[model samples]
Target: MDNKNRYSISDQSIRFLNKYLNSFSPTGYEREGQKIWKDYISSYVEKIVTDLYGTVVGVINPNNSPYKLIIEAHADEISWYVNYITEDGLIYVSRNGGSDHQIAPSKKVVIHTKKGLVNGVFGWPAIHTRKSLEEKKPNLDNIFIDIGAFDKKEVEEMGVHVGCFITYPDEFFIMNHNYFVCRSLDNKIGGFIIAEVAKMIIEHGIDLQFGLYVVNSVQEEVGLRGAKMISHAIKPHIAIVTDVTHDTSTPMIDKKIQGDIKCGLGPVIGYAPSIHKKIREFIIDTSKNKKISFQRLVSSRYTGTDTDAFAYSNKGVLSSLISIPLKYMHTTVEMVHKKDVEKIIQLIFETLKGINYSKEKFFID
Candidate 1:
């Protein structure tokens, strides 16, 4: 079963990836991004289910089945929330997720306001004026956004107020025609891959013994809130989750601390406590049989992605994780190899085609 042609990344898909990654889908404010994902997959699935908190599920086989399978990725990205408006119109923000404070200063951002997009820049002190030995570095406490407003009233007039969400304005771009560099790839790329898997499943006319739920979850950066909710809602018998793992091959990254993972090598298969041994082996077998390239990952206590959310749900769902090796995770310039992304989609697509949920041989005693 050669799936290279069917699951290969196309130019049209790259265009979609650019638009989707450039769109602001900050945590807790994911409706717009979910709409983009749901629209892209609507033609490929029979039914779409959106949770109250904006987790979107596209069901290929909606009818009742003996087993349910969920291939999920989170839609939300780390961002900031407007916590306070200084009298001088400077905006103080709090973490909406795990926003990197070190990268916040001097970066461009957009405040999602009721009026429209309000542009702002994170202000920092000049290096020349700072005493290097005693200078205070950028942190949540001191970092502030300058919107060029005179006072708090002026900021309010611009539709920027407390509780407004902010995200970087970094657009998606490809480097050397291979690496995808952008903000929020931490898991948006996950959503993109799973959606592509569903697309391939429909295009290739593959049949599965169990219902396949293509889930794009929300709020994963903030403790997997969305995955936790949807895992309960779906109650899937088996979950194959995809998220980004660090590519430790880059400069300044210690392989001993981050593990030996690299982009363009292959998809990553997780060895975590939450990962069901049988399910893990099943995916590895499928990858090997299909001649798909994949790397290995070992998680100490938890996989730290949506994998943990679903693995612990429904009194322990059988779960495995497949990750794309990502570089500079959680920053504006997060990157992954195009080959790795395509391989992940292929791996997930092939795994779904070959999985036998009804066969006890694939399940542990």
Candidate 2:
């Protein structure tokens, strides 16, 4: 069997993708999701190392190589924190990590509590009762969730309280045949792609020149906290961070502001000051050489992804960002093209196979 024919995404991987995306992994709380990711990639890696705050790294060719490369993605999803429980047992929430209040109304939610998952729904006033001219939009102050509790006492009895993280219960599904739709595909798709890259390396029997660290970072929805801490711990020589970028072709999004990107157009490569110019060019070259389709996106001072964290780490790591085109980011219906997902996985896989360099030589040019 030919190498390319034998090595492609399998049914097992699709099953794992569905399972991983459906699991709750809110910012600052990603242990369970990380466990699922770690277990899936364990067979493909030489050894696995986890940090104090639950950043998981699957180290390949771990011979204490001075030159290390990292392929990373965040595991956490945007969520809401139970900020205030009203006397009527209504829960007002605060942003856990860019949670969209406008879309919260009528969506199903799961509040993570010590007692396990408690179901709830963001309740809104009936249109018949609201005066159109005086209607208020859903904001942090107005959006509330009802857990069918009549009063605060009932809510408390159900183990609901302030500071509990709430996530959407939306499961992964295929849309219009080629798009992956779910609530947190903003970055969980990234974790899945990195794992697929690892699987490719193992099945193809590719020998790596550097220690490859596949990192599933936590707390990215809040900030680049996980990537920041893990960068210091790994101190990699080169890093490729994958995340989601806006698909401005969708309705209501201005292409002039968000950049003109579309789903299924291939992986999007970010250009920013934080991205190392030398390594960025190397990745572009690799993509061209491999005949992979990719789009370019120019960013402001910071790329606003984990790339910034790794790029500005100790002594600076050569980092780049590869984003998948996503529609309706931060909403329950976040979507990404399946082909774009495959492109990113292929790009990273081919780049790793071609990166035969030392840290000293990388900085020379």
Candidate 3:
């Protein structure tokens, strides 16, 4: 596809991502986002179901393929919850997921309360007040959110209550021709990819021999909890976990320490023991045949994404990991290449087409 065609996909992905990312569905509170995903993907899939934990599963099976395949993505993002509302109305928050406190200071955030949405900024100690601790990075426990309310009564009147979810208020922005930045690309990109693949399967009228389940999991950022439940329920024969990996273009990271996966280099295929050797080879072969560029990533142990859950779910599944190279992971300004997104989707679609039920293999314990 040319740049124009690529942008079309990027534009659609960005539109869907922005709509879902701006929704107030942090880890344990993903009901709103789940509803949106169900509504959006219902038209394209054969059957859509929600697990007990609110994980959304979309199936597209044309020829009743014997093999069950899962493309897993997490819908949750890192966020904070109001733990205490002080007498002065400043809200102290507890981190909900794997949040990096270094990026919390002086950042804009949204407080999702029972009544309404409240805008706030994470405040850092003033320079004069921090003279003794100038070189120290403040911990998350010391951070507070200022919503411009003067007293506890005002905050209460504004519907700011304990347990309200708070997230960074960063809007999506296009950086270069194919690069874009957003707040929750950590896994929203994965959701977009699976949804688009479902749409393409329907549009092209391609029938797969195996059943394909596209899952938008919840609480992955917290502990990969959602995947564990859904994977057990589905008991897939093969699993592909899509998430963002580090893009080491910024300062402080050594290029050699991390593999040379860049934003526009296509998707990163993870090489870990948990990943099935045959499945990984098939993916690479498909990408090569389709002329899609991809990078090989080596993971020493367990990948800290949904792959960890799928690899060990219900006596284990043949699992592999594909990552979109993302710059500044876990921060408000996460960036990814639009071309890489398209390539990743294409790689996935092609891999689905290449699945054969008769060639199943097992790993020895």
Local accuracy by lDDT, each model: 0.90, 0.90, 0.83
Tens-place lDDT per residue, model 3, 1-365, is: 33322213845656776787666567988898778777889988889889888899999883486568999889988898899999999998888897778888899988887677899998887777766645667686687899999999999999999988898878777786667787888888889888988877777677787788999999998889999999988889889889999987767888788877777888999988788788899899988987889998888787888898998889889999999999988888889998898888888988887776655443322
lDDT of 1 by residue, 172-234 (tens): 998998999999998899989998999898888888788899999999998999999999998
Model 2 residue 108 CA deviation in Å: 1.1
Residue clash pairs of candidate 1: none
Candidate 1's displacement at residue 267, Å, is 0.6
Residues 140-161 of candidate 2: C-alpha lDDT, one tens digit per residue: 8999999999999999999999
> lDDT value for candidate 3?
0.83
* Candidate 3 runs further than 4 Å off: 1-14, 133-136, 359-365
Residue pairs that clash (backbone atoms under 3 angstroms), model 2: none
Looking at candidate 2, what is the lDDT of residue 67? 77
Q: Which ten residues in a row have the lowest lDDT in candidate 1?
A: 356-365
Stronger candidate by lDDT (2 vs 3): 2
lDDT of 3 at 198: 82
